[model samples]
Target: MSTPQLLMIEDDARLAQMVGEYLTQSGFGFHHALDGASGLEMLQQRSPDLVILDLMLPDTDGLEVCRRIRAMPSNALAKVSVLMLTAKGDPMDRIIGLEIGADDYLPKPFEPRELLARIRAVLRRRGEGGSDAAPAAVMRFGTLEIDRNARTVTVGGMAADLTSYQFDLLVAMAERAGRVLTRDQIMEAVRGRELEAFDRSIDVHMGRIRAAIEVDAKNPKRILTVRGVGYVFAKQQD
Candidate 1:
């Protein structure tokens, strides 16, 4: 298998250099762009497997960059996994990033080891960074179809746009259809990380997933929320 390539769009040159070295030593091909524009161009040219986007950029904000990536004309590029880097202690920034389609986020001033772990987790959900293998399986519920091999979800034969993390979250819930899972349980199932108190990242991703698969995101039918609980995937859907 080819080495996974990562693009880091960070304006902090020293930090980027250090991270590039660390990731490169850890068996990844690393590339760097000082600003969002150059990073977007590099994304098209290099087609890296994942991107580490910094929230504060010299040219444009990371939120706009993530939006542009999701809006790209090329589906492959648009769907490429994104792991954002946000300011430490800023939950709002992370929430906004996730809402706009980032696969995951790591706060600044973090240990390099934690960053590495987050990257591996994001890629593992996308079925790239892990060595474990499983047979491809397809799950169907009414008009919704989830193809595990292709890592795709479709509704009534039309493809649903979902980020890598969101896709895994949907699969985890679908696998346990009709069972209510708390936000921590859901995040643990997909991300293997405990959620911080008051963290609403799971809610953000769930909203995005509903928007992709539900005919009416406002009144979701496929994934239902249990007040004072978590969420449950409907066993029967149309």
Candidate 2:
């Protein structure tokens, strides 16, 4: 396997330098962009395996940058792994980041080792930062179709826009069909990690999925919540 390439978009020159050097020594190929605009330009040009994006950038907002990447029509660019760096302690920022398709994040003034660990975790969750594995099989339910091999989903024969994480969550639930999975189970299956206390991240992602899959997101029929329990995929499709 080739070394994973990483792009870091940070306006703090000194901090970026230190972190870049550290990540390089830690076995990743590093590219540094000083602001969001240049970073996004580099993103289009290089398409790194993962991005280390700081929330505050000189030319643009970090959140907007993430949104732009996730909005790309190209599957490869839209699904690229992102690990956010922010100085804010607000949980809202983290929630927003995840909602915008960031794979993970670390609040600023963090240890470089922790950043390294997060990078690895995000990459692992993104199927070792790259996957050429054969798609398992096709799953069909009414107008909804999931092509595991292609990692594509379509509703009514039209392609549905979904982030990589959203797709994983949908597949995990759809595979189980009638099972009512707890939060821990769902998190474990999709993220390979347990849910944290007071972590509503799963719910946020679930809403995103519903909007993409359900004809009426306000009255979702596919993935239904089980009150105190987690959620369940409808076994019987109309």
Candidate 3:
């Protein structure tokens, strides 16, 4: 397997340098851009496996950058994983980042080890299309089809756009269709970590998925909300 490449879009030169060095030593190909424009340019040019984006940039907002990334014309680039870095106590920024398609977030003033772990976790989930024990390469439910080997989803033979993180969440829920899963259960199913009590990132991703797969996101038919609980992937999807 090729070494995973990472691009960090951060304005703090000293912090970017330290992170670059640390990630480099940890066996990753690391690159840095001082601002969002340069970062987006580098993203198109290098096509890194994942982006480590700082929430605050001098030129463009990190959330906007994430939105633009998700809107890219090329499917490969649009689906690239993004892990955002936000300031401490800025929970709203983190939530906004996720709402706009960021895969994960780590707060500022974090240990390099923790950052490394988060990076690995995001990449791991992206690559885990399905395990050997998985039943089939493609899972179908009515008009919705999930191709594990291709890492793609289609509804009524039309492609469904989904970020890597969102795709994994969909797969997790689809695999356990008919079960009512709580937020924590869904998070643990995807990444082996319990959901943080206050974190609504999973719900954000689910909304994105429903928008992509459901004909009408406002009244989703594929993934249903089990009011007062969590959600369920309808075994009988239309």
Candidate 4:
């Protein structure tokens, strides 16, 4: 495939300039917009493969922009993956970003290499369409159907619109239904990445997955939270 296209919507002009130079060397077709409005307009014009969105924009919040992208009519634009950047201290920013459909997030004041790794991982997870991974058995939990081969999910015969990350997360838990897997274990199953001391994006991603599959996200039955242990998929479905 061609060099993956990327659009960075950030208000930090100095940071944007520095990132632009790095991305050019890293083999990406890159563009930058200083605000959310221009970013949305150029999103249609570019149809990029991935977006590096800053959580704090001058005109609007990045979460809102992410919502708009997912709501866009064009299949290419709507499904385009997003990577959010935010301050390191505010944990809520990361959670909110995922809740609104961001594919991944990296905290601010991060190394360039870390950002590149996140960008590549998010793009690979979204772009592969399950081609690179080995096929797994399809999972059926009563009215919920998970086709690992097709990377699709259906609840009560209705399709669940899940992002690539959410789908992988659901599949991970479903594969071990009835067994609670800690956040580290879940991350390992999905990405094979080493666990960090305080990586809470798992919960945020789980919330998004519940919203997509559960009959009532506010009171979920499919994926049960084990309080401090983590989450478990129901072995017996209604």
Candidate of highest lDDT: 1
The sequence of per-residue lDDT tens digits that candidate 3 reaches over residues 1-238 is 6889999999999999999999999989999999999999999999999999998899988988999999999888998899999885756787788878888888888899988888888887777322343345899998888998688899999999887778889999998999999888888888743456887788788888989999999999889999989999989855
> Between which residue pairs do clashes occur in model 3?
none
> Per-prediction RMSD in angstroms?
1.2, 2.1, 2.1, 2.4
Worst 10 residues of 4 by lDDT: 125-134
**Tens-digit lDDT string for candidate 2 (60-152):** 889999999998877788888888999997888989998888877788899999898788867765666554573589999999999877888
Candidate 4 regions off by >4 Å?
129-137, 192-199
* Highest-TM-score candidate: 1
Q: After superposition, how far is residue 43 of candidate 2 from its true place, in Å?
A: 0.7
TM-scores of the candidates in the order shown: 0.97, 0.90, 0.93, 0.88
Tens-digit per-residue lDDT, 1-238, candidate 1 = 8899999999999999999999999999999999999999999999999999999998899999999999999998999999999885778888999999998888888888898888888888888886576449999999999998889999999999999899999999999999999888898777655567888988999999999999999999999999999999999877
Candidate lDDT scores, in order, read 0.91, 0.86, 0.87, 0.85
TM-score of decoy 1: 0.97
Q: Please count the clashing residue pairs in each candidate, in the order shown.
A: 0, 1, 0, 0
User: Which residue pairs of candidate 1 clash?
Assistant: none
Pairwise lDDT winner, candidates 1 and 4: 1
lDDT of 4: 0.85
Q: Per-residue lDDT for 11 in model 1?
A: 98
Deviation of model 1 at 114, angstroms: 0.5
Candidate 2 Cα misplacement greater than 4 A, ranges: 130-135, 193-195
